[model samples]
Target: MGIDLEKGGRIKKRNRTAPKSENPYLLLLVKLYRFLARRTNSSFNKTVLKRLYMSRNNQPPLGLGRLVKLSRKNADKIIVVVGKVLNDERLYHVPKMTVCCLKISDSARARIQKAGGEVLTFDQLALRSPKGSNCMLLRGPKHAREVYKHFAGVAVEGHVKPYVRNKERKLERARGRRPSRGFKRKPKKV
Candidate 1:
């Protein structure tokens, strides 16, 4: 007797019906988006709903500097982000525009308002643009985590980062990584 799965013990689909957070505010937003997604035919609403179900790690924060560059082309459209907006000190000058996001840092909010720009929440955005018209959706780089740099086989073999627990010189320069311990590796013939 054995158990056989339909997908051969592998499933690559999102199965979340709702967010895992019990935060009342977040739950309220989820409820609002759920209705909007069901009632409206706009794919934007569906996309927003899907992002709302993502975990905290998946909801990466955006920076003010990159945002300015992203909205440079379509400055009039409202910028939408499903994560926090952080202040980037590199951005000395801010531009006037409308932004809608889940969270905003103190400095970022101050800078935006000082530049004659307005910040909005998801609910307010829905009231203004029910169908998500004249809105540009953006997200932070999800693979920006340091662990991604340690991944191997996807790129150059020698470029993968190694975990070093000690700073001692003797601990390194040994075995497969060094030529003195054994036969040195050679590049493959082209």
Candidate 2:
């Protein structure tokens, strides 16, 4: 009826300006980042603010191993992740690190502290690096979930793991699974 009526009616734009989380702490972090993102001309603050607005699935948790590997080259800089930091049992050793994340697992926190590392929250990170200086931002594997594995396979590769309801030796492992059952389809390299 107003301005958009002449140009295809009201343009329906459904997007997240702020996080949907009702948590006070999350809200506080959002507020701080919003201010920082607006006041500061740094691209890092803008990136952080955009990531902060992502959903739970969008902001996947980073593993300790991945973090260690990624921050290896830039050891002196503070690692900033817009999601939770998780513990990886596969990684035997952990080095001293300065990490800033929204959430952290107890074991992960313990391991980091045990290694003489320091953990900082979003607010603390803002205080430390208001302009997001000397920081390396990282994210976890988004499609690491089991459900994604079923759908996220190359059909041309012939090595796709299809989703099946009943996984049993009598049925699932019968036809195109093993050579003994019949003949396993070998993946043809392209």
Q: Per model, state how many residue pairs clash.
A: 0, 0
Question: Could you give candidate 2's per-residue lDDT for residues 37-150 as a string of tens digits?
Answer: 899999999899889889999999999999999999999899999999999999999999999999999999999999999999989988888998899999998877666655
lDDT of 1 by residue, 21-116 (tens): 998998999999899989999999999999999998999999999999999999999999999999999988999989999999999999999999
Which residue pairs collide, candidate 1? none
Candidate 2, which segments miss by more than 4 Å at Cα? 1-13, 152-163, 167-189
**Distance from true position, residue 140, model 1, in Å?**
0.5
Q: What overall lDDT, based on C-alpha atoms, would model 2 receive against the true structure?
A: 0.89
The candidate 2 region of ten consecutive residues with least summed lDDT is: 150-159
What's each prediction's TM-score?
0.85, 0.79
Q: What is the alpha-carbon lDDT for the whole of candidate 1?
A: 0.88
